[model samples]
Target: MQPSGILETALYVTDVEAAAQFYGGLLGLEVILRAGDESVFFRCGSGVLILFNANKLKDRPKGGLPIPSHGATGPGHVCFSATRDEIASWKSHLEVHGVAIESEFDWPNGAHSLYFRDPSGNSIEFAEPKLWNLQ
Candidate 1:
């Protein structure tokens, strides 16, 4: 059997509050939940974006649900689907907010993509669905 699709995407950050500001305040994602300074969850389209402070995982409160500890160190990458128009808008919005655009280009398939880094240095991308031949 094959899994249907992704339901969550996780990105490790140094500070939940700063990450929250970037994802929530800048990107306009809806804040769904917050777990003290350890983690924060945001609703992104049909999926959830989870930001976790890896440094605090070892000290997380014990014995509630026995969830396995999970996190990644160093920089990670994540991409959001965007239309051409939306990408253009995003470029302007990001520049206005002082979020440097690391790279922006057209793929061989003619799809467009833009990249940037979050506060924690995680690579963030916005690309046209056509980049993957998606409709």
Candidate 2:
């Protein structure tokens, strides 16, 4: 059997509250849950964005199901889908919030994207739907 689709994505951050402000307050994502000061969860379309304290996750109890403990120090990346017009609007919105635009890319398939960083230095991208089209 093949995999269906992504259900969740995560980014390790130093500050959970700051991450919540950036993803929830600035980006307008719905905050689904928060695990005290450990992590914060946001609803993004059909998937979820999880921002957790890397150092804390490293110490999480490894239990029954043999779940792997994952954490990273530096930056992580996640891309969100948007329309061409939405990309433009997002660029402006990010700038107004003092988030710098790192770059913009024009793919051969006509899809475009804007790249930037979150408060924790995680690389974030907003690209048109055609970004993953194989044709």
Candidate 1: where are CA atoms >4 Å away?
A: none
Q: Give the best candidate by TM-score.
A: 1
Off by over 4 Å in 2: 61-66
* Residue 109 error, candidate 2, Å: 1.6
Kindly list the per-residue Cα lDDT of model 2 for residues 1-135, writing each as its tens digit.
Answer: 988889999999988988898999999999999998799999998999999988788778768568677777789999999998999999999999899999998999899999999988999999988889822
The lDDT, on a scale of 0 to 1, for candidate 2 is 0.91
Per-residue C-alpha lDDT of model 1 across residues 1-135, encoded as one tens digit per residue = 998878999999998999999999999999999998989999999999999997888677878897887878789999999999999999999999999999999999999999999999999999999998888
TM-score computed on alpha carbons, candidate 2: 0.92
lDDT of 1 at 134: 82
Question: lDDT values of the candidates?
Answer: 0.94, 0.91
